[model samples]
Target: MIKSTQQSDNERWDGEGGSQIAELAKSLAIEELEEADRRILAFLGASVLCLWDELPDDARQKVLNRELVQSSFDASVVRARIALLFK
Candidate 1:
């Protein structure tokens, strides 16, 4: 019973994370892509997703956490540049 519960929890987490990733990818496609680029980007995104899924859970978590930090830093840098331009 406990094992079944753990499996369900993992499935729920995976489903939620997958949906979030898909939504973000779709939003990026809408915002920045031309129609011609969409197919190529979608193919690349699928390939990356497959690779991501093959990673061990711990490795995937580490990579994602590091990416979050890097993304935060990048956003801050961009914001600072924009502020400088305005000033």
Candidate 2:
């Protein structure tokens, strides 16, 4: 369900779309990741951010209680912290 939706969102974002994370990452001159890798990462980031954007305001304050958010992070506090940008 959401997986397919996210894949489509990723594709759309890779095309004619603008996002904060992509803008911030675009300024980096580092060669660690190629442009392709950067795009792939950006698409994945869009999926997560879009997911978080759909949540209710109250749930946004305490995402740990939301199974969708928790499962999306897979119990990784570090990974989940990235979504805190919305909070």
Candidate 3:
């Protein structure tokens, strides 16, 4: 099942004895996770980045659409426009 696979992946990621490439793959797997699930995985990933000399491919691509980025951008633009009006 999908849930079991995901759990197993996390377990594998947390396990020891992988090469740098293996660890990178694990981090990439975590990057695609849901936000609630991502919280701890993000910490684990940051630890890997800090401890390991090598990093995985940049985790920029979203597994799904993320509206938050556009929403925040819109808010920031509105705030800037408002600030200009007050200035």
User: On residues 1-87, what C-alpha lDDT tens digit does candidate 2 reach at each position?
Assistant: 999999889888767334533553444432455565456546765675689878787765553333344344322343344346447
lDDT of 3 by residue, 1-87 (tens): 999999888778657333544544444434444564456445655776685545433443221114433334343354455457557
Candidate 1's C-alpha lDDT?
A: 0.57
Where does candidate 1 have its weakest 10-residue lDDT segment?
Answer: 24-33
- Most accurate candidate by lDDT: 1
Off by over 4 Å in 3: 1-33, 54-87
State the lDDT of candidate 1 residue by residue for 54-76, as single tens digits.
87898777644534634454434
- Quote the positional error of residue 50 for candidate 2 in Å: 0.7
Ranking by lDDT: 1, 2, 3
- Candidate 2's TM-score reads 0.28
Q: How many backbone overlaps does candidate 2 show?
A: 0
Give residue 86's lDDT in candidate 1 (0 to 100).
51
Judged by TM-score, which candidate is best? 1
TM-score for every candidate vs. truth?
0.38, 0.28, 0.23
